[model samples]
Each structure stands twice: as C-alpha cells, then as structure tokens.
Target: MAVVFDRPSLWQRVRPHLRGFDWLLLLAMLMLAGLGLLAMYSSGYDHGTRFVDHGRNMVIAAGIMVVVAQVPPRRLMQLAVPVYVLGVALLVAVALFGISKKGAQRWINLGVVIQPSELLKIATPLMLAWWFHRREGQTRAFDFAVAFGLLALPVGLIMKQPDLGTAMLVLAAGLAVIFFAGLPWKLVLPPVLIAVVGVVLILAFEPQLCADGADWVVLHEYQRQRVCTLLDPTRDPLGKGFHILQGMIAIGSGGLWGKGFMQGTQTHLEFIPERTTDFIFAAFSEEFGLVGNLAIIAGFVFLVLRSLMIAADGPTLFARLLAASLATIFFTYAFVNMGMVSGILPVVGVPLPFISYGGTAMVTLGLALGMLMSIAKEKRLIQS
Candidate 1:
C-alpha cells in the first residue's frame, strides 16, 4: 500500500514568517511611502536618478524592516551592549580619520563609506533601554546618570563632527527611553524652563545677538548663521537667508490647496533648495498644499500612536522602553523636518520619514520601525 504524504505549498511555508506583523503599522508605513514616491517623482523629475535611487532605497528598507521584525525583543536585549560599543568605536574612528563633505566630518570610510552617527540613533536607545531593563523596579539617580552617560558620549562625538541635527535626534531617542524608564520630573522641568527662557532671550535680543561679528560660542559659525537667518530671512535674502526665504515663499504659495502635483513653480523651477531631500516637505506642500500637509501629519500621528500602543503591550520592560523610544525617533524626524521646512525651526539636515530621499535615513528608519514591529509581534506571540 502506498501512503500519500502532505506537502506544504509556498504560501503555507511562508505564512509563519509573515504572521504576527502589525497590519496597522504596515498600513501607515505604506501610506507614507506612497506619498514619498509621489513627492519624489515630482520634485526629483530632473534631479538625475534621484527618483529611481529613492525607489530602490525604499525597497531595500522594506526588506530590512521585514527581516528585523523576525528578531525577538529578548534577543535584541542581548545585542544592546555590543551594538552600542561598536557604534561608539566607529564614531571614534571617524573623528580620528573621517571623510568630510560639504564641511561636515560625519562620515567614515569603512570599506564602503558609512555614517557612524546614524548607528547611534538606534544604538543609543538600545543601550539605554537595556540599562533600564536591568535596573527595573530598582532604578536610581545613578542609573539615570549611567544612562545619560551612554547617551552623552555619542551625542558629544556627533557634535564634534558638528552635525547638530543628528545629535539632536540621538539625544531625543535616549531621552525618550530615560523618561519612559521613570526619570524624575525634577530633572526634566529645569531644562524645560531654561530652554523656554533661552528662546525668549534670543528673540528679545535678536538684533544685538545677530549683528555681524557677533558670536555664539556654543554654536558653530554656520549654525549661528542659521539661527540669525531664522530670526530674519530678509537680512541677506540672496545669501545666507536664501533657503529660509525660498522655503517660506514656496510654502505660502501653496495657500490652502496646493499648486497641484508637478505644477509647483518653486519646486519645478528649482527655487526650493534640497527639494528632494531635507526640504521635500516644502516641495510636497507646494504641490499638495495644506490639506496634503495635514494628511502627511495624520499618517505620522497614526504611526507614532500605534507604536506607543505596541510599547504598552510589550511583554517585558526592555521591550516597552525600546519600542517607546524607537517610536519617538519617527516623531523627531517628522517634527524637525516639517518645522524647518515651514520656517519655524533651523534647517538642521533632518529628513522627513518615508518622505525624504535619503538612503542612510531610510535604512535607519527601517531598522527603528522593525524593532517596534518585533516588540509588537512578541506581544502577540505571548498572547497566542
């Protein structure tokens, strides 16, 4: 007698790998990615192979996200320290002998040219979350201090590279982890008050502080120029202030309903600088207008909220902290990019998530979101 054996088809064989993914998270990502493609096609129509390269980058990012989603959060905790160490080591190497492009020494030549600062974005959070996880239920001021130490090392290095935008992102990621891990309100409020007061003083003394030959010791010359330009773009509208002025003009030109796709004169005519990358939001706003901006914001809001919910459902303290902190990376990316484009913040090289044409940034975004998906997937596995 011959026995018939059952064979699993391709769908059945692959189903397990696809199971437990957060569909809502994926939906939000897809919506934003679709928007990015549209924005890129329009803004990068004549900008070399940017549109094609962007599409290729998105595909690579999506593949990475899917693969990273399979890694368990518990396994990721084990990786925290080593990844952090590797990131720090690479940063040191960059400082000693790194590539400088456009006056920023932020990239290191490691076989293939790489930006070590981007690694810190994820590593800093992972290290802090792991620290908090180990100290859970018994965390103290010293633990928070250690956490800050882990955070500050990379942030300082990035600043030395003088890439303030990347430093701010790394700092924000670590702070989110610490805050979620039960940092004291007393420690938080002082900085908040100081920052508010500092802003007030800056605005009050804009003219004196921004006068030619005036210097802000804490900021690099270019950074100072950015702040001064932000204060008044009309000062040298054709020189240092051109970016801000052009961005404002493009944004305002969109009015309520945008200029309709590729018809954006500012974008198509090359008036909006970096229209395919950092300032793509201006390009997007020019074409899609206020309504489009709202939709973009809403998509981000959904993604962030969904990530926090994933954090809340996390099975372990490490998972919760990592997920929450990683989610805020998305928040920082979107907020800073949009604010700078809208002329409310400094142009600090931050990219809008899924909407900016950047290989490094998109890869970092994929890895961060993948970690969140892993946490959410783990929770589902536990429940099942």
Candidate 2:
C-alpha cells in the first residue's frame, strides 16, 4: 500500500503558480525599487530612521504584491463592488470625523490610522471596469452616465476633504477605465479643449489674476496660490513659493552628471523640502542627474507599456479596462510628480511611484502591480 502511493514534488505544486508570471514586468518594478532605495539612502540619511523605514515599507509592499498576485483576475471582478462600497463608507466616516494633519482631513482611525482616499484610487477603476463589463456589447450613452456617476461620488467626497492630489488620482483612474470602456471622442474633446483654454487664460492674465486678494470665484484661496506659484515661483520666493523654488534648484543643479551620490548640496543643505517623500524626485535628480533621471523614466515606461499590452490581450472586458486604468495610474503618478518638481505644474499630494518614500503609496502601487501580474498570468494560463 505504501509503495502504491505517488506524491507530486514541491516544484510541481509551486510551478503552476510560477508558470505565467511576467518576468519583464517584475524586472521593471525591481529596477525602480532599487533606485528608490538608493535615493532614499542618500536624501534621508540625516532624517531619523527614514531610510530604514523606507526599506521596511518596501519589503511590506513586496509581500503584499506577492499575496495579491495569487488571486485570479476573475476573483477581482467579484470583489469590485463590495470593495468600492466599503471604500465609500470609510470615506463618509472620515468626512464625519477624520484625523486632520496640516489642515487636510483625509485620514480616519479605526484601530490604526488609515487614509480611505487611497482605497478609491484602485476601487474607482475596479468599480468602473465592473460596470462596463456588465454592460458590454449592450453599451449605451446612459451606461456611460452610470459609470460617470459612480466615479463622481468618491471624487466629490475626496474634494470635499480638499485632498486634491488623491482626488486627481481617483479621477484619473476612473476616467481611464471609462475611456477604455469605449467612451466616444466627442464627449472627451470638449473638456480637454476647455481646460486648455482655461490654462491659457490664466497665464495671459497672470498679473491681474494673481494680484493680492484677487478673487478666483471657483478655486479655493490655497488652490489659487498654487496656480500662481506655478506661474512664477519668484513671486514669494521666501514664503509660499519656497518649496517649488527649492525643487527647481535641486533639479537644475544636477545638470549633465549629478553632483555625485550622497553629495547633493541642495539636498543636504535642506533646501529641497520633502526630500524623502513627495519631492524625492528632485533629490534623486540632484544626485543622479539627467542620465539617472532618464533611467528612472525608462523603467516607468517599460512598466506602463507592459501593463497596457496585458490590457490589450485580456480575456474579458473587465480585465482590459481594469488593467488599462491601473496602467494610467502609474503614468499619472510619474507625470504629475515630475511636472510639479520641474515647476511645470502645481504641487499636489502625489507620490512618484517606487521612487517616493511613502508606505501607503508604495502599498497601493504594490497592489496595482499584483493585479496586473494576475491578469497577465490568467492569459498565459488560458493559452497553456
């Protein structure tokens, strides 16, 4: 009886899970993570435990990514609705009594302090993809309305919290899903044209619009200040413009070849504010310079392009839309962070994916990467 039994080897059992894992996607992520550690060590050396904490957070995010990757994309569709509902409920709770830090009420403490807006960054796309999935092949204008309605709720709540950065992220993810779900170009171009015109108007009337006590009827006072600061950081060099001014200095000082690893004067002199977090891109640019910046950008491009390819080949419309939206999330994070640091855009609460120091942002990115891997794996498994 003992001789009659045959057992599968451990490799045989684990091999199935490994079969379709995307090595190229993993290579891109690892490359970015390596740069993040390098940048964090240089910029956060003097800051108490920031470097150590950043490494620990990366490990945690990797663990999350591995765990999430095990779940099939089909399972994600089942979760889309409930996860979104839970996210919205938590947002409402935060609105009622969330923790406020530096005048932003974006966190809530259940047991451990948490930010609900982060959940919507992923959930909005998931919900939207799910909506379009249900309505696929029978799509209509009304269906798009329902999709936008789903998107607007959380965006409005996040804006009410005045967390423009997170709101922008959520909005971008949702819109990406809707756009991929076959939104018409006719509906898209008007808003695009309007925003272009508005930016031009603001620049043309900068003096009158930015004058002290100028009333921008729609924009909040701080929002107006951010716009004006982007236009001219010199307006209040030692005041409201300090952060942007410092960022530009750090970026420009890096030049062709960076100052040298851990030898950035702008970074070490404490001129670059938020050097470990939001503005880590500037710190990285200071030490690594243009060449290094190009490498970092190349990594992101690889990740995004690979993600979109996976989306294009997805077996289901849900998978396609979800993957595409998540892909856009990466692009938006990088674009917005780099734009703000280079003084091309107003500063926002966005992080530069793996290159930024933040446990929450890192984990969110990890979750997204895992989902993409799952979708990629699902396609391969089907072929096999």
Candidate 3:
C-alpha cells in the first residue's frame, strides 16, 4: 500500500510555540542600543568615568529588558493597579518629602535616592491599559474622561512638583494608552487644537504681559521665559537662550558630512551644553552630520513601524494597546528632543532615548521595548 503525506509549512509548525519569543522586537531594540553605545563612545570618550557609567547603564537596561520580556501581558496587567497606586502615593510623598534639585522637588529617598516619577513613566501606561481592558467592548465617552482623570492625577502632581518636562512625558505616555484604546478623533482632536491655540496665544503676547509681572494666568515665570526664548534664541545669547543657540550652531556646523567622530569642535570644546544629556543630538550631529542624522531617523522609523505591526497582529486587546503605547513613547522621545534642539519647541529637559546618559530614561525605554516584545510574543503564539 502506498501512503500519501503532506508536509506542514514552516509557519504552521512554528506559530503555536512562541510564548516568550520576539526576535524582531529584540533585533530592533539591540540595533538602537548599538547606536546608543556608538554615540556614547563619542559623547563620553573624553570622560573615562562617564564612558564607564554609560556601559554600566546599558548592562542594567539590558537586564531590565530581559526580565520584562519574560513576563506575560496578563501579568503586566495584574500589576498595573498596584504599581500605579503606589506610584501615585510616591508622588504625594515627593510633594511632602522629596529631594529638591534644579529648582524642583522630584526625587525621594529609598535605600538609594530615586525618582518616583520615573517609575510612573512605565506605570501610567500599565494602569491605563488595565483600565481599558476592564471596560473593553463597552467604552463610552465618559470612559475616556475617566482615562484622562487617571492621566491627570499623576500629571498634575508632577507639574505641581514643577517638573514640566517629566509631566509632559507622563502625559504623552498615558495619552498613548488612550489612543491605543481606540479613542475617537472627536475626543482627541479638540484637546490638541486647544493646546496649540493656547500655546500660540501665550507666545504671541507673553513678553508684554510678563514684563509688568501682573498675575498672568497659567505657566510659571521660568516656563514662560523658556517659550519666549525658543522663538528668538539669539535675544539672550549668553543667558536663558544660550543652550538653544549653541545647539543649533553645533548641528549646523556639521554641514553635509560631519567634521568626523571625536573631531567635532563644538562637542570637544564644550560649546554644546548638556552634551551627554538633553543636547547629545547636537554632539552626534556635529560628529556624524546630516547623513548620520538620516540614518538615526531611519532606525527610529523602522523600530516604531515594527512595533505598530506587532500591535496590529497582537492576539489580545491588552497586548495590542501595550505595543502601540510603547511605539508612541519612542516617537515622543525623538520628537521632543529634536524639536527642542531645533528651537521649534521649548527646552523641556527631555532626554533623547538611549543616546542620553541617564539611568532612569534608559530603563523606562527598556521596559517600553520589553512590553512590545511581550505583544510580539503573544502574536506569534496566537498565529501558531
């Protein structure tokens, strides 16, 4: 007797067993991390200790990414409430007993001094995801209002701490969750339009009103000054506007091709402020030039697009929302950094993801990537 057998396709055999697998997400993350190390090598090449610190942070962030990737999306949702509640509690504690630095009280003492706001950077999205998951298939207009409330609670506290930059980031991350929850354009567009108009009104008439110092509504004096300074950076070349002016000069100096790595006069001469932090892009642009900038942008675009694909293919609502929010965070970090560097946006102290030398931001980014990995893993499993 002759028997006929059909062979299974590769996807059919592999699809069902991807519980903790996400190679594409992993690859994209590693690529960004590699770029980060290259940038850091140049940015901190002169400072031995900083170079070492950057390496250590990279290791730590990698560890976080691994641990987060192993956990399933269901587990992440289970922890969301407690983490977010504790995060809020810490923010309140920060208000009462936080360490003051750079004119803001935004840190707390644990076994080691740490910023609770950084923890909320991850928790905010987690909580929002959990909330939407609970209300799935029955969302109302008021549901979004409630989601905004969840966002505003932490954001309001952070802003009260007068940490405008962090507050904005937290806001963006939480809003990402809402956007991924399938928020209506009617709900989304109005707030964004109002925000734009409000900003324009503030900028168009800030100087005249602020000159008299007669109780202007909203925005602290320093915050207002930052916005005005962005409009005309050279107005106070050696004062409040110096950072923006220097950043633009450094970026422009690179021309078509950079002066060459470690050969950037602006970076090596220390004309660029916060070269290892907020303005690190200027250091990078000065060294690598426009061609290098395009490469970095392409990498970001690829990473974000890959994330969106994972979200689209995710099996569960929770996984989809988490992946999308993580992608949005990537976009937000790049947008804020480039905008501030180019003087189109006010200097809000947002770190360039991966490139900036900061433990908190790197860890937050790692966790975000891990969430995407979880989503991708689930999608793979579902396909199987």
TM-score of predicted model 2? Answer: 0.97
lDDT of 3: 0.84
Q: Each prediction's Cα RMSD?
A: 1.1, 1.5, 5.6
Ranking by lDDT: 1, 2, 3
lDDT score for candidate 1 against the true structure: 0.92
TM-score of each: 0.98, 0.97, 0.91
Model 1 per-residue lDDT at 371: 90
Question: Which candidate comes out best when scored by TM-score?
Answer: 1
In the range 27-99, model 1's lDDT, one tens digit per residue, is 9999999999999999998989999999999999999999999999989999999999999999999999999
Candidate 1 — which residues are off by over 4 angstroms?
1-6
Please, what are the lDDT tens digits per residue for candidate 2 over residues 302-339? 99999999999998999999999999999999999999
Range of the 10 consecutive residues with the lowest summed lDDT in candidate 1: 103-112
The model with the greater TM-score, 1 or 3, is 1
